[model samples]
Target: MSEEDVVQYLQNTPGFFERNPALLEELTIPHPVHGGAISLLERQVSLLRKSTAEYRGEFERLVSIARENEAIMKKSRRLILKCLSGDSLDDFAGVVEEVMREDFAVNYMSMVLFTEQPLDTSVRMASWESAEPIIKEMLAQSGCYCGVLSVAESEFLFQSQSDSVMSSAIMPLVSFEGGQVVYHGVLALGSNRLNHFDKEKGSLFLDYLSDLLSALLLRLLP
Candidate 1:
């Protein structure tokens, strides 16, 4: 009989193995690693061992990821607490900048609010009247954007530090009250290393930070 016919016969008649149990001992195949022949039972054991090893490696990787996410969450909680402790926009900005420099490990970071708010104008912000078209475009996309920044975009966000920065992540900050945009702002991050930010980077943490910033900024409103 052909190999396919033998396989089909074996599958069609499961009782054959029980009836002819002695045939199992007779069955032998060339070993994959060793030069000698091995029984079918040994081959099956080898396959099981390989599968178990693969599963173990996957479990270890998952554990590592869990630990990393936990660490990141701890840092995020600290940042949120710091943001909430500030009484004014200037205080809030200081906390954000200091935490980002000390904790987030960013080369440079800044905030820009596009609306007239009751804060010191010297606190690194531009009102809606002063916002350029590029800023509007950034808000139009309306999410965390990570990658290399163009010359115009970098200049607009970083200004004096534009030439020093090689990569950037831009997150639009908007607080909504009943679907209406109340506070429009931008959080700009810069890095001297070209590969610091990539397009494929996950947005979960960035989104969380933006939400926290937006919530804290809501206190500025009337």
Candidate 2:
């Protein structure tokens, strides 16, 4: 057969190497890194080594992620305990902000709650009966929204200190009574670092913290 025909036949054939065991070891290929040729057996070994290394790298990445998640969850448990141990809503808010700054390395943290009537707040808070469109839009997001925010949004949340914030997260807070949302709040966290509150970061931990805070606040609120 012609060279083309032979090549085509091999492409269509399965187990051609197994059928021609002698040829498998008899051939040679140019080494990728070295300038010299190597035996077919050595070439196969090299390819296998490369593939094995790739798989090992992937396995290591997965292990690292698992370890990181485990550590976060452990810290989260402690945070939850500290939060729940508070004697009153004000105490709980203090613990929440303190823990967030110390454990999460946050630059700024504030809580904004909407209410029909004014209520005493524990931490830095803004109470509004009717919010601006920008504020309402953020609350309507339903959950955590993170990234570089607009000048208006930053100013609305952070006010005069807005200039220092490079990244921010706004977590919508809701109180459900009889499966209906009754009250809404916004938990805002900011950082000077541009990458601190990135959209790419997972929000599972944030959601957990917000859920705990919302539930606690709801119990104390009307």
Error of 2 at 155 (Å): 2.5
lDDT of candidate model 1 versus the reference: 0.80
Error at 140, model 2, angstroms:
2.9
Q: For model 1, how does the per-residue alpha-carbon lDDT over 40-115 read when each residue is reduced to its tens digit? A: 8888899999999999999999999999899888888888898787778777778888888988899988788775
49: Cα error in model 1, Å: 2.4
lDDT of 2 at 185: 71
RMSD of 1: 2.8
Count of backbone clashes for each model? 0, 0
Candidate 1 stretches with Cα past 4 Å from truth are: 15-22, 30-38, 116-118, 177-183
10 residues in a row with least lDDT, candidate 2:
122-131
lDDT of 2 by residue, 154-174 (tens): 887888889999999887777
